[model samples]
Target chain A: MAYRENEAEAHDEEHHEHHIMSPKVLIGTWLGLMVLTGLTVGAIKVDFGAQANLIVAMAIAGAKAMLVCLIFMHLWFDQKYNVMIFFGSVIFVVLFISITFIDTKRNEPFRDAYDATNKPTPEGRVLVEPTVSPISTSGSDAAAQPGELKVPEHQKPKVPWPSQLPDTPRVAPTAH
Target chain B: MSEAAIDADAAHEDDDHGHHDEPFLGHHFKDHDHQFNTGKLGIWLFLGQELLFFGGLFCAYAIYRGMHPEIFVEGHHFLDVNLGAINTCVLLFSSLTAAWSVRMAQLGNKKGLMLMIALTIACAFGFLGIKYIEYSHKFHEGILWGQLFAPSPEAMEHAMHGVEANSRLHIFFSIYFVMTGLHGIHVIGGIIAYAWLLKRAAAGHFGPNYYGPVDFIALYWHLVDLVWIFLFPLLYLIH
Candidate 1:
């Protein structure tokens, strides 16, 4: 037992040293991370047009995450197997997001149809299709005009409110 | 007190076989490198799984944010950017110290290792402290998750300012709570791990031949920071 122990101890002494990441490298990585963080925050201020802004922010963040993985986590110098494992997770995450987006897009037309069927139109009031022309409501006009309260064209008393039509009895359609 | 006594002391020291008595080395491993390398591989696998776990949440955030882009744009205004930035710095600095601790252990600088571990723990606590303030502010403002969401006057004002106060705004706060809450739990776990490492370091269990625990824990700490690196921009830096 003593002899075996001495051999193991000799092995331990022989392999005691490891690749110690230098303090300079670590501090440099931290500085790089901080700078990337600042860039992300600053990118938000740049008018990158809505979608582009989000893209830029995500890009900066991705850069920061990569730095942490490569330097601080030691994957840059560590075994290739470990890097493979980490990137595998990242790749799976991207796949998950991509699948979800595809499904959402696939169902979008059905969602629009559902909305059209369920949307309620008030009695006697045709839903005005939106137009490029400016729509000024008489209410705002009346509020603005102190002396004259001109009735809006839609609210004129000459138009009769639509009376409720009698409920028509109908047979239920048979299932084919 | 005589010359013979000194000679006997020297003879005893020689008989002990200096640097060969490592009580910490387990019998199964051939040497320290084998044990350390094995531990490192195991930790990498565990960290990979951790990434997958959090990846699910990130996917959820992505889907919802894509669906209700306006909700996120409006809801993010409630979160204070300065606090998030400060916490990010704290976690990054802690990661630095955590990495340093591993180096110290490898160099057999017990004092430096212990001090770095302690600093890492302190920084972890500071992170939780800031997170607590942020969470409480959210709670007090009634920006809660799901059914518990009751927007305070301030939150209501912000919501009314845009997107017509869709109840789906609750989804943003829900994601916020779930993601940051999980990360907070990770931070707490990190604190506990660092504290345990500090005790072991104080007991002189770690050194050049057996610093696997320090290295593994530092790797874990860096992962926590890495996750936050993404979370900070996604949640708090919304344009």
Candidate 2:
């Protein structure tokens, strides 16, 4: 019991080293984040060209993210391992994004070609045919008027139907 | 030894080890520091995974924007920048309170911790409320994703001013809804976490020696804020 009490006292002494962020730092970080937020919003007003504007917005956002991770999340006062883990994840994310961008950039020509060849229907133009059945099988004269299928020009099937295909020669029967 | 004798010995051993005395400390951990460090490491790993999860959406946004910069240029005009900015401020304030709550827990100030936690919860709800307004406005305007991308005539006028609506505008809204929807889900998760913390705190469950839960949840709340830090600029402030 006495030994446990002594250990507890030592633990108490060690506990003082545990870092607790000050309110001053927290408030300052908050204020900085707010100012950065304002800057991001305000940046949209200026004509920095599209790419330059995106870069400026991202830069400010990156700063705010750093502040949140370092201070709000206490990575600054945290163990080195924690910091490494967080940053390693960020690096992986960057790699993932960049690789995806590279792949997409390489495929841009294909995508453009596809888009050009198969243009989507114009706005408010529904390409799907109405759901009601258009064919009639009754022998009556009026029923002989097979309903015309209003298939969209682009959506019409390219291959002929089985009934429309040329007949093939019959094979000889095989011995059982 | 007999069973009763073994049980007695185990009880005495626990008494000597002082595990029972510290109700909050886990029996398996060597000490408070061990438990706290382990919990912190676990949360950090989860956060790392979370980054990658959100990273996928960001990659989609990058690819789509790269291909259709015009869509983004037109799409962003439909989003309410003022509401987005207000929500950003709200989240930032909530993050401050969350961090402060951790400090409060560390300092063993129950009232301060409770106050900060409550404030953080309030701010989170405020953010979601503003988000609700934005989403409803979009829904009403028919500015939606995929096949549902038919913008009302007025919405089209508002978005384009005079330019024709891009057919691929739905792609932008798709990215927008997926990203913001995921973030809003995280906010809801944070609210649930904070509520749990609040309940434990009301029962006087946290203090300097056992504030790991508070700290872990605060880290999570900050991460949600971190995601929004990038999201606000990417989705709302597009050029």
Candidate 3:
């Protein structure tokens, strides 16, 4: 037991000395990170159009982030469990974004068609288009304008009140 | 120390062969080397998880950039490249101090360790001060995100004065703020950890034989510096 214990202590001391990252490697990572940052910033300006720009910028950013994690964070030297946890979190984020984008873009068409079929008509349940008449009285323009407002007096809109002339093709504005 | 903290003699489920009688060995570990390996491994794993957290933010930036490429290009014009580069240089200096601190600890040089750690902490504060200046400038520019808030147009006008881009540029700022802010939090955390270790180092809690904490903390601080290395370009450089 004593022998085992002494051996463990010696091993412990050796372990402590072995794991510290060398300063040379440390300097290398620093330079790498600096260059990577410069490149990513430079790339943002090139017009890879819309989609292409996003991908390229992110890929570079990911690579840079990885360098920090691997070299400075010691992820490159760490335990499997830690790597697993990190990867798991990343996966969750991906799933969330995918689900939300899909739900927004895919369900749009059916919603528009459904809204159109439910449109209201004045005469019948199934909703038919109103007929246009030669002496249309759908509004009050003829009531107020002394003969000059006429498209012919009989053709004046017949809403009864002069103030009741609703402009065609105009929808009243609604509050947001 | 409690017996719980020293586990060498308690139970051996496997064959106890070529190893025995190791003094000052923790009870929890099978051997000193194994314990050190585990500690180093643990630190790296934690770092990986942190990287992934930032990774998600990077992914968001990509998606938004793809959707609105012009906005990113225009947003680049607003970044103060000189300031970003200076801050990056400042952080690189901090990493040097951090590495020196760990080296001092390994050599059992207490005073050198404390000074280096203090320098590191100061660098972190310096980085933060630069960050504050940048954010306030943004406040002056009417530049901000559209998530649960729109930056008051008045302030944004000052920060992004003379800049021409769609309102979508605000999204770019949003990602910028979140990513940089998170990185700042890590820097703060690293400083605090270093401060605590600095005290222990002063009291001789670490030496040539027990420098794991110092090494790991330095490693963590270096990672913070590493993140800034990339941020400087992505945020400040226009071309």
Candidate 4:
């Protein structure tokens, strides 16, 4: 019992040396966090453009994140290296975003090239419901009603397109 | 054998134990403030690096988002705002308790310190529980991540409830899962840390002048909570 009591007295004597932060800062931080939380939820109702919407939401989230880090997490009281850690994270984020965007840009050229290779060759025609009319009906009554008309030129292109439209007029011409 | 010698031996044992326990202490330190400062600086450095690590993930999110804002929003619709808001509240409050625990430790209030630490752990568990609920909801909706990721009807229902919705929306869920999952993992780590600290604190290992462990842990727990603050808004609060 004496041992425990002595330990307690040691703790009490030690407590006389340090200074805790004021209650005002704590209350202010709490209030600020609640307000930001409400705003984040509120922003959902306002539909900005796709990109702007994300930007606004993220900006608010960042602010809230800062509050938690600076105030609640006590980065406010820490040494210089603590600041270094935070900034280092920010630099990494920049690198991650840059790399990802760079890759996206890189993929764009490849996508175009891929599309070029698989473009429709017009080599052959599989008979189907044509997309556009091939012949003119200047003096004939053979033309069907517009609603029920079938066009030959505008056919839905074939599967497995092998190449681009071949460089010449190879198909026989239809007299208009 | 005699009472006088037995008393002398007990005093000697205490002196030896106290000296051996303070190896990291310095001459300038009366109560281990030097060790505390070193440990605090170390934690802050670790936290700074962690911030950057998570920052990298956020940057990835930004790129994907920039490339496909519509897709991102489509996924955002799946998140439950009400639940997210509540979780934010829980985490923010947990941070408060963590702060209080450190304060109690500094005051050498063992009972108060233990209670606050326990409170913080409970808050972490609560955060985890809520996270599980959110994740299970995603699972039920068929929403997932990576190549196997899919959209839940609820997610889709929430997502395109009012937009030019399409199948491309699944990608949004993909980012959401990656970001939130990583955050969830951090919350788990903090919970384990809290438990260890709580045990030590309850055993009265800390006094007013030697509570660096509690401060560092609180700093970490706050960061964990802080990360969620950003996550909640990004994931759940977009139209």
lDDT winner: 2
Interface RMSD of each: 5.7, 8.1, 5.6, 7.4
Tens digit per residue, CA lDDT, model 4, A1-176: 56345544655543322446456777688778888878767776788865676678788778877877777666655444566677677777677778888777544433333333333333322222222222323343323324323233433223312223343423322210
Judging by DockQ against the true structure, name the best candidate: 2
Please write out the lDDT profile of model 1 over residues B101-167, one tens digit for every residue: 9899989999999999999999999999999999887888888997677777767776466445654
What ranking of all candidate models by lDDT puts the best one first? 2, 1, 4, 3
Candidate 2 residue spans exceeding 4 A from truth: A1-17, A123-176, B1-15
lDDT score of residue B8 within candidate 4: 91
Model 1 per-residue lDDT at A138 = 42
lDDT of 1 by residue, A105-171 (tens): 6544334333333333322112322121122234543124443333444433332211212444333
List the RMSD of every prediction in angstroms: 14.9, 11.9, 13.5, 13.7
Order the candidates by TM-score, highest first — what do you get? Answer: 2, 1, 4, 3
Score candidate 4 by lDDT. 0.69
Over A138-159, each residue of candidate 2 has an lDDT whose tens digit, in order, gives 4633224445333334443355
> Docking category for candidate 4?
acceptable
Residue A154: error of model 3 in Å?
56
Candidate 4 error regions (>4 Å): A1-19, A99-176, B1-31, B150-165
Residue A46 in candidate 2, Cα distance off native in Å: 1.2
Best by TM-score: 2
